[model samples]
Target: MQNRITEQPSNYRDLEKKTIEELTKLINTEDKSVAPAVEKVLPRINALIEVIVAKITNGGRLFYVGAGSSGRLSVLDVIELPTTYGVAPDLFQVILAGGVDRLVEAREEMEDDKNEAWEKLEANGISKKDIVVGISASGTTPFVLAALARCRKENIDTGCIVSNPDSPIAAQAVYPVEVITGPEFITGSTRMKCATAHKMIFDMISTTTMVRLGRIIDNQMVNVKLINHKITDRATKMLMRLGNINDYDTAKELLFQNGSVQNALKSLNPDNYPA
Candidate 1:
């Protein structure tokens, strides 16, 4: 067993004696270290992202398997990709320990089941083409570790995000990112800095993957779905700017007709816009 720094005693003691303001300030100070911890592992993160991009480009999907806060945070990230990047919802998926349907229930006990994660992955028709990334702040969550071990046995590519060094979960991953955020402000409560690191890393993974896959055009979400009036209006303006159209109504009309900024731009006539 590895020394789990996340479970070590916090640097700050006498928490009960601290004032509300003092508590908040101390927590905020600890939060400041999370970004730097994640930064230290960028090379490992880059390696994982490269594999993810290649697999996705080759028609494979990305699967995030996690438990507790790590799992819930992944759900938030995966759900936004479709509307934000205009990609299929199935392109990114999450397999939470207690089933995503029961996510709000906070079934922390489910993380102890060693076989459930692999069973869920198998039911999804998991294959070698698809990549599975485990999220476990403790680096020893049985649900996540079991899944990664099985994935390796089945010849599937695996990666992991953990806060402890030489963790069993990291050992199973071909590409492991150990952010090592150290002890949480609340001792073993990984939902603090560890969760923050996981959330930030998820943002980096999804956003960078989308950009590399060309879902973003010049830093703009040109492929974004016009799901609501606000999004539609935004896409309309984007089309107007990118298509170089002079009239808002005309741009909105073309945007509606084509369904998105990317498509509307494609429908524009080369000679219709001023040079």
Candidate 2:
């Protein structure tokens, strides 16, 4: 509704009669711009990560609020935090515009109601002990902005990830993240570039925050929950490599005994020294 396509020519229209190779070239070109845009916001992002780490360390929670494509992506990011970094599921939550059913399906009409966002947060018992990161593309999503405003009124720390600088959402948040991913290839269809930018920003935030919370060691996800065979396999290998064990059996045994790669390494090696 912001008429974002009018401001950027590259987002005006799609190729009408282009070859597959040509279309791919254009898309790849647009994709390349996303990271650089995110790069500009790294300093702000680092600060927000530090803040989130402090809150989490103090037994607080992290909330992601958004609508439509942004909301679905935020949910995906938080859903993986537990298995990927060993964070508590209850500590990380997603508040979509119309709720869980809308995430998988469509609920475009729900994006207009500002009060619904606050209701969602209230249902979760949001407090000042929590950190909220709102995601929106045009930075004008009433749902996300209103949720952030309510959080601010309640004295909760708030941040945002948006594609436009000086957006209304950014203006309302204390720590605003402006990725400036430009316009979409489909002219205001933010599910394209904006969605990718929000995902990248969410990844950076979660990964960096977990690192600060000691969930990682030397680029290894040491706190990853072994919730499945794939994770179990990864944990076994990590334990084997870190403990200098010779066989899979020894690694698996230690992993089972200690229940974690970090603990297994401690049992096997004691310290990073030749035994």
Using TM-score as the measure, the top candidate is 1
lDDT of each: 0.92, 0.81
Q: Residues 165-252, candidate 2, lDDT per residue (tens digit)?
A: 6778887788888777776776767888888888888888888887777777677877678888998999988877777787998888
lDDT of 1: 0.92
Residue pairs of candidate 2 with colliding backbone atoms: none
Candidate number of the best lDDT: 1
Off by over 4 Å in 1: 269-275
Q: What would the per-residue lDDT of candidate 1 be over residues 4-34, giving only the tens digit for each residue?
A: 9989999999999999999999999999999
Error of 1 at 118 (Å): 1.3
lDDT of 2 at 192: 84
Give TM-scores for every candidate, taking all chains together and pairing residue i with residue i.
0.96, 0.90
